[model samples]
Each structure stands twice: as structure tokens, then as C-alpha cells.
Target: MSTQQTISKHLDKSVIWLFVIVFLISASVFAYRYKNYKTCEDVAFTVKAKEFRVGELIKFTDNTDQAANWEWDFGDSTDVKTNKEVLHIFNKEGEYKVRLLVNNICQDEKTVTIKEKLFIIDSTKLPVFNVKSSIVVGETLNVEDKTNNASTWEWRFGETTRVNSVEKRASYVYKTPGLKTISLVVNGDVKHTTTKQINVLPIEKKEERISEITGTNRRLGDGIKARPLGYEDKDKEKTKDEPSDKPKVVPFIGDSQFISKLELVSNNKLDANAFKEYFCGDINKNIIVNGKNTSFLIFCEKIKNKKLRIKDITIYREKGSNCINTVTISQNKILGIF
Candidate 1:
């Protein structure tokens, strides 16, 4: 072969070698990228919570690529959960290492710091309030602010579920004869408020009776006789001396005395049933804390474990009956009492 022909053959061999090298490099790059993309498809999860406090429910959701099975370990010694989306609660507060295992192979973890729940209302922090206890129907009740910095006040007299009066000092009158609940919100802090109950009495009425002597005209019959004047007087004296059989009146517990008992009940359970007769024979009977009407049970719960300052209490009775139908209280109430 000639020198030029040999040189051309060598050039052709070099070009083929370069093309083969380029193909190999491209294939290697593609394979490396595919491997990394597969790795990115591994199992993953997320945790959601309203608050990191004990007794709060926490949510765990799986987000694994092509995941078929899921297992959750809350790390709080709870049951091993098996669900794509699961809820968990931790009884005790502490740092928990939550883990999610998918398909029994891939895993992810999160650390949750749980805290202790707190009493939402601090009654000790509330300001003192005052209102007149003797609230009568058709009479205006004046609610006075005893503390400083109170810019607004909203009062509800339990007649209706609406704010009847709003001012730094408010006045309201209850129309019906029932347990009346008075609510006071200061400075628009609706969450925390002062609640009072007062019994509005009906209009007073007086009852009177007149007695008179009567003369009787009698005719003497064959077998009838008239008693002697002295004998009749003696009979009257004996009848007066004999024991009377009239039923004695039942004792009544006045409203003022019941107010004393409630003032002492701060957080203690008192004998509210002592006045059951006044409340139609059931102390637990719903007497309005009067939530624009709060139940007696909820009112008791709100006063638990707190120092309560009672401003006043009123007892309202029916015009002719000794039974009390309404009672009101004024106090510095905790935030959640109502």
C-alpha cells in the first residue's frame, strides 16, 4: 500500500475510537443519574399538631414513593400503629422520637417536644368588681367599676341572652321572677369576665283579714236546751287552753343567709340542698349562673380551685310564697367560669 492510503486508514481508526469513547461517557452519565433518582424515591413522612402538649392529638402521614405498607412508632410506649395516616396521644409530657417505617425497610423520624397543659383561667389575675345586691324588678341595677383601667363593661341581666348594658358602669333590671344571671365583661375581654346572679323580687302585696262578733237567734225545741252563759264561757276557756292542732309553719332559709353560705364556698362544695324547698326541692335544679344562662354544675366547676371574691348575692321570692325563685351573685369571675 502507498503512504497516503496508510495514513487515511489510521485517521479512520482514530475517529471510530473517539466515537466509541463518547458513547461510553454518555451511557455512564445516564446510569449515574438514574441511580440517584431512585434514591430520592425513598420513604418520607410528616407530623402535624395543633399544640405540642400532653393530651393533644398528633397526626402522622406517610409520603413514601410507591409505599404499600406503613408502621408508626410514637416512641411513647403506645401501641405500634399500622396506618397510612395515624393519630396518637402521649399521656406524659416529654421529648418523643416519632418514627415512620414504610414497607418494613425505609424509615424516617421526627422529634416532638410535648408540654404540660395549663389552667387557662387565672382568677387571681382578674380585677375586682362590684354591683348592688338588692336588685328588684322594675328597678335599675348599677354596676360600678372598683378597679382602675377599665375602659368598657358589658352587662347581661339574664333576662335575655343579649348584652343589656355596656359602659364603664352599667345598669339593668330583670323583669321576671327566676334565678337571674348577671354577666360583666370588662374592656372587651369576652374570654374573662365577672358574673353575678341576683334574685329580682315581685312587687310587694299586703294581705289583711277583719273579724267581728255574731249574735245567733235560736228557738227551744222539745229535746234541745241552751247552755248557761257561765258554762259557755268556761267551755271557751277550756277550748283555748287545749293544745291547738293547726299545722306549724315550715322554717324558711332567708336569701341573706344563703348568700353567706355561697360566700364561704369559694372552692368548697356546700350544702346547697339545704335550701331545696325554696328551689322546688332540687338544689341541682338548673338555676340560671343565669351563660347569658350558665348551669349550676358548670358554675360550680368554674369556681373550683380558685379564690373567689363575692361582691353580693340576692334572693327573690314570690309575692305570697316563701319559696325563693331567683338568686343573684356578683363576683370577680374567672375567664372560663361561664
Candidate 2:
């Protein structure tokens, strides 16, 4: 072969090999790019901000696995950050689109809103009111809101979970005896509410309780009020009973109230006397507790030092005078194994 023809032939062979190598390299790169695009379904990240407001610092963190390269566009500014985590502050209050480019391929976007500054109110400067700290049951409890700027009022008398009154000056008569909480929400702002506590005292020993009913009450039946003083006939009790003037007054107590008082007695905060009005003014009224027979006063004393979980409580009342007839309780003593 001629010398020029041999050299040209070698050059042609070298050019063909170069083209084959370039085609193989391009095909491998295209396949790898296609695999990465298919598996990048979950482009996950987290944004942490104590409060999303103007001038607040917001932290953006990329949570994608095997994410080596990061591109964060906070969307508020044209600047982009290349880091796994970045902190940015928005200068204005509005919604902004946030975007992230993971490993220069996986792309995702989210929206963040910056809010205006919230109005702050001093809770100490909230409306104040006045009420008597203690009052007898059946007596009217008067309250007056003294806040000068208060035109609307919401009053809740802790006896029930309800708004009892709306006037600036309110009054309520308690039917049961115990501590009660009174709340006032002025200007319809319940967040800055003012509250007061009042104690409704039971009828004292000296207080006179006239029987409104005409029929005579059951006297010392079924070991109830074990004392021999006949409650029905004053004439029969004039000689047998020790007291001659004052009629024995039993304070009226609701079934729910009785259960609460029992809990207080278990905590040692109260005693059997707390339920005097429930049982013909006799704390020692006979009753059944968890199928065990015992006096009311003795039952209270038994659980006085116990931490108890009340399982069930039942109260029976005389239909005539609404006086407590029988009480059955089922309570579990907690941490009192001995």
C-alpha cells in the first residue's frame, strides 16, 4: 500500500473509535439520569419557626435521604442558598413560595405565610370585680364589675358550666354548700377573665329551719339518726330530747354534691359534719358502703386519711321532705394496702 493511503486509513480508524466511545458514554449518562428522576418521588423538608411573623427567623431543613447538594430558594428574596439547612427572615407580612432543589435534580415547593404582629394585652390590667368571699346558702350573692370601660359582661357561677348572667351587676343564690368560683368576662374577652372564689356556708346550729311540709318526718328509723330524739313530734321530744327550743335542721344536699363532699372528706379537707344537712343534722346516720353497713360519720372517718377513687355513689331521699334516707357508696382506696 502507498504511505499516504496507510496514514489516512489509520486516521479514519481512530475517528471511528472515538465516535463509538462518545456514544456509549452518552447512553450510560442518560440511563443514570432517568433512574434518579423516577425514584425522587418524596422531596421532603421541614420548616421550624416559633411564630410565623414578619422579622421572625425561620429555619428550613432538608430531610431527603442521600441528599448531598441542596439549593434553597426562600421565595421572599432572589438570593438562593446552597446548604443542607438555612435560616431566613421575611421582611414583609404575606404568603411566599418556598422551593428546594435536592442533589440538583429533585425539586419541590411549599408556601409559608408571614403574619402581622398580634395585639398584646396586659392581663393584669384586665377588668376587676368585687364579691363577698363568704355567704350562707339561700342568701343572694351580689357582684359588681368596677371596670370603667366594660360595657358587656359574661358571668359564670361555678355551680354550673354555663353563663349565668350578662349584666355588670349580677346576683345568685346557691342551693348547695361548698366553695364556689365566680368568673367575669368583660368586653366579651374570655382570655382576660377575672375570677373570684366564694364559700357557701351550711346552716349553723343556731339557725332555725322551719319544716315547710305539713306531714311529720320519719324519726330514727333503720338506725338512721341513731339518737332517740323523735324528729316528727315536738311534743313527744319535749321530755325525751335534750334541746327544747330549736328544731333539728338537716341541710339539703344534692346527690352530686354529696359525692364531692365525700371526696373532700377523703382528702382530710372536710369531715362528716360537712354532710350534716344531708342527714337530718346527724353525721352518724346509718348507711351502707360497698355492701358493708356503717354509720355515715364512721364511714367518713374511715376514708378521712385515705386517697380514694370513687367508683360509685348512691343516695336515697325521703320523698316527703327530701331528706337523705339511705346512702350506698363504692370507693377504692388507692395506695392504702394495709
Candidate 3:
């Protein structure tokens, strides 16, 4: 009874243990396979950028698993891109909705804006002066000027003087003056003129001027034809043709021009003669006076170190003719008189 019963019990136990081991191995293998297999819902899609300029190109990407296919919508009216990375252009300036679908189940959406950035003109030239305001009975008349970006200048001081200056300064003499008009032209383009009223008083009643007459080392006032007729040291002299240490007399000459002697006294008195000498038929070369040039009348005054006041400027077709027109000037306006 002991041997038979023991063998039968051992066999039964072995069979039950084998069945349990096989069942456990099969269950473990099935669980591992289920964990690795991915569905369309498990994949994720993304866009690399969220902002772009107007008319700029953009790209979309997918980082999803089991995403063998992709579809894109750029919100603009255009065809879609089926690749993982698709190129798109934003043509308009506004916010746009971007959508990407991966494997027909995974999806991502983004919003971006395209924009354009916001652009004034400025032009005006400097002012030129033609004449001064007043002169004393015995005061000297010196004309000068200051300007920029000008290539030429013309100055005219009524019938007493006409000057052409390449420098910024020139001069004229008015021995007697009631009223005169002074004019200036720049770059052969712009023209400016003013009329002044010179009230001549007695020599004793005039006031002395604050400045004195001196030679100029630099070029004379504004753009004109004449080179500087001033002075400088021997070593600091300018070119050979340029006038150095020499003074030119301001002459008034023309068929209708009158030459007058003018002087400024120490007491600020302006002494001027009213249309004294005749400048009729005086043939000359490049005759420049009062900023105007002709063949007979020449301006010879060097106003580097002098100051003169102008009263009125009258233009006539001929000498001793009636005043046809007049120009008025302001008190605050600055002038260069030689």
C-alpha cells in the first residue's frame, strides 16, 4: 500500500506545476506586445514657429509616433502640404490659424500674426542780404555778406556803385543818399533785395560807428566774380592773382549811372552827394556794381573793415530818370556794406 500510493501522488503534483508555469509565460508575452503597439491617438504633431513677417515662408513639423501621413491647413486660401515638414507663405498682415493632422487622429493648432512696419521730407535755403539801413553824414560805406551752398553772388548799390564779388564780402560808396534799393542774387538762382531810407544829418549831429576799416585775409563776401581785395602777411598770402594789401575804389559807372562821394565822420555822420558825377558811356570789362555786372560800370570798394548804412534803392532805365519802384527793409535784418 505505501509504494503505490506515493508514486501516484508525485505524478499528480508534477502535472499541475507544469500547467501553471506555461500559463504564466503566455500571459507575460501578451502584455508586453500590447504595451509597444501605438495607436493614431498616441501621436503628437507641432509647429516650430508662432510668429512670422508678412510674405514670409513658414514650416510645420510632426513629432508623433505611428504618423506615417500628415495634412496641413495654413488658414489662407491655398493647397495643403502632406509632408511632415511643409512650406507655407503668409501673404496678408493679420493673425492666421495653422492646423496640422497626424495619422488622421493626432492634431495640433497654432496662431500667428504677420505685420508691416511705419516712414517724412525736409528742404530750405539760407537768407542773403543786399543792403544796410542808414549811414551818417561822413561815415564810410562797406558792403559784405554771409551765405552757404552758393556758387555766385551779385550786388548793386543804386547809381553810386556796382560790385561783383566771388568772396562773401564787397563794398560800395554813397556820398549822398535819400533812399536806395539794394539787391542780391545767389548761385545765379535766388535773388533778395531790400530798400532803406538814409536820413542824412549834419556832421556834428552824427554818431561815430562802432567798427573800423581793415583789410581782409579771407575771401570777400558771398559768391561774386572778384577775388579777395584784402591784406595778409607775406608768408600767409593767397594765390598770385588774388589781391593782397591793396584797396579798390568802389566806382559807379553806366549810361544811366551816377558817381557820388560818401564818407562816415567820427561822430557817426554820413556825408553823401546827391547824383554828382555822370557814369554815362564808360566802357569797362566785367563791370560789377551792387552785385550786377556790365561792360562799363565796375565796383571797386573793399568793405572788409568798414560798415555803411543804406537808405533807399531806386531803379531807373536811364540817369536822372524818375524812380520807377522801391523796396523796403526791416530793422532786425543784418547786412554787409563795403
Candidate 4:
């Protein structure tokens, strides 16, 4: 071959070698990308929750690549949700297996624990007893439970009989009563325990009933008629000396009181008149916080510059005592209670 023809042949071989190298490099890169795509097709996600309390809303965010659809199984036997960012609520307290299905092809799962929320028992939310703080021994005491979100109840009558009941409404006749500590737990959760004190009077010390009519008098006819029934002679006395029939008013000073009032309102313990006493403005807004549509009462408990500026306040009407369910307040408010 001539020298020019040999050089041409060497150049063609060199070009062919360069093309083969480029093709190999391209194939390697394509393989790597395809492997990554397959790995990504199996959804990658993160489940974030600030709290895991029952009845709390949790948000799950999908961070998967090339994901076209998202499906979530909260493991509560509820409906499955399809969204890039899904919100879920667990009503019961337990460990829930949360599964995420991406594009109906790949799935990932996480276990979340739902714990019982710490609840501050309010007396106004509890059942009202027919008997007063003091009752006679062997007297039947009637109690009606009016608590909110309560599915079950356990009551300890605090007598020597060791009596207990699971009914929402119960009556107990105490055989012996002195200073008794009556306790109740709702929803079978010990976190909802409430206790109160009661006094039982002995039968021997019972007071005699007074006659409706007065004894005979010499000066006046029928002893001046003994005044009219339900008539109070003290009414003619000074107002300060006479007791008022109105309920004692308690001022809302800090966030603790505000939260207490909110609980009372939610549990149907507070009437409309009492509701207006703590809150100043209209509280009928349907606002949502933390993905819940229920009513929430939020406030700043700290007195900044000797004045408190009310923050987010939401209120809505529901059918039962669960109307006002959630409450969020300043940290100072909780500290102030102590």
C-alpha cells in the first residue's frame, strides 16, 4: 500500500475506536440513570409529626421522584387519601401502620404511635350530682355524666362498699359516709381521672322540719299571718347584709382561666350568659388550626406592657358538648397556672 493509503486506514481505525469509546460511555451513563429511575419509582417519603396525640392531625409529605399519584392508608380502616401532601387523624390511641403507595407501583410504610392526650379535668364538664357536697348516710346520690368525647366512664363511690360503676349515669346509696373522695375516669383512660370530696351526715344528727304555720299570737290575728310563703323579711334590710341570688362572677385574668373557660364552653358546662362573661367580642368564627375544623380558643396569656392582646380566637357551634374541642394558648399561660 502507498504511505498515504496506510495513513488513511490508520485514521479510519482511530475514528472507529473513538466512536466505540463514546458509545460505551453513553451506555454506562444510561444504565446508571435507569437504575436510579427504578430506585426512585419506589416512593421515598418523610412522615413528620410534631405531636402524636389522638384526634390530632398529622401531615405526610411525599418526596419521591417522578411520582404521578399518591395513596395513603392510615391503617385506621378509614378511607384512603390521594394527595402529594396528605393530612390524617387517628381517633383511637395505638400504633398505626401508615402505608404510602406511589403511582400504584411502589409502597413504603411507617409506624406511628397515637397516644392519649393529657387532659385537664374541669368540674363544670363533669356530671352534676343531685346531692350537694354533704349528704345523709344511706341517701341515694344521683349523678349524670355530661363530659365531652367520653365513650366510657368508671366511678368510685368512695364508700367502704368499694362500689363502682361504668355507666354514664349512676346512683349510689352510701351506707357509711364521712370524708369521701369520689373519683371518676372517662373513656377507660386513667389520664382523664377526676376526683371530688363529699361529706355524709349521720341519721342521728338530722335536723327536725319546721312547721309551715306559726303558733298562735295574742296581739295579731293568725300571728300576723306568719308572713307570706317564700317571703323574706331580710329583703327590707340593707342590700349588703342580704345575700344575692346571682352566681359569683369569676374574672378571666390569664390564659389558664381562658383555657378553663374554653373547656367549659366545649363541654356544654357554660351557658350563653356565662360564655359572654369571659370573652368580650363575638366568638362565632369557624376557623381551623392544625388541620382540624373544630372550634379552638387561642390567646396570649402573658400581660405584655401590663396589657394582653388576644390572639387567634375561634368558636363554632356543634350539636353536643364536643363543640369546643381544641385549645392552644401561650406557654406563659400554662406556666401561669402553676
Tell me the whole-model lDDT of each prediction, alpha carbons only: 0.65, 0.74, 0.49, 0.59
Q: Give the distance in Å from residue 137's predicted Cα in candidate 2 to where it truly belongs.
A: 1.1
Higher-lDDT candidate of 2 and 4: 2
On lDDT, the leading prediction is: 2
Give one digit per residue, the lDDT tens place, for model 1 in 3-91. Answer: 99999999999999999999999999999966654332567788898987778888888887777777888897878889899988888
Q: Each candidate's TM vs. the true structure? A: 0.41, 0.38, 0.25, 0.33
Q: Show model 1 residue runs off by greater than 4 Å.
A: 1-15, 30-119, 124-127, 132-134, 211-338
* Cα displacement (Å) at residue 236, model 3: 63
After superposition, the stretches of candidate 4 with alpha carbons farther than 4 Å from their true spots are 1-38, 41-43, 117-120, 127-157, 164-338
The better-scoring model by lDDT among 3 and 4 is 4
Compared with the true structure, what per-residue lDDT tens digits does model 3 show for residues 1-338? 79999999999999999999999999999899677555676555555544565556666677776777788888887788899777777766667888887766677787866653110011234335545567654576666655567667676554444343445576655554344445555565332322233343335555888697886576656456554677455764546657656432333443222222222321223222222232221212123334443222122232212343334333333323332221121111112211
> What digit string (tens of lDDT, one per residue) describes model 2 on residues 202-224?
87778678868686666656446
- Output the lDDT of residue 326, model 4: 29
Error of 1 at 255 (Å): 33
**Candidate 3 Cα errors over 4 Å, as ranges:** 1-38, 46-51, 117-338
Worst 10 residues of 2 by lDDT: 329-338
Best by TM-score: 1
Relative to the unseen true structure, what is the C-alpha lDDT of residue 209 in candidate 1, on a scale of 0 to 100? 64
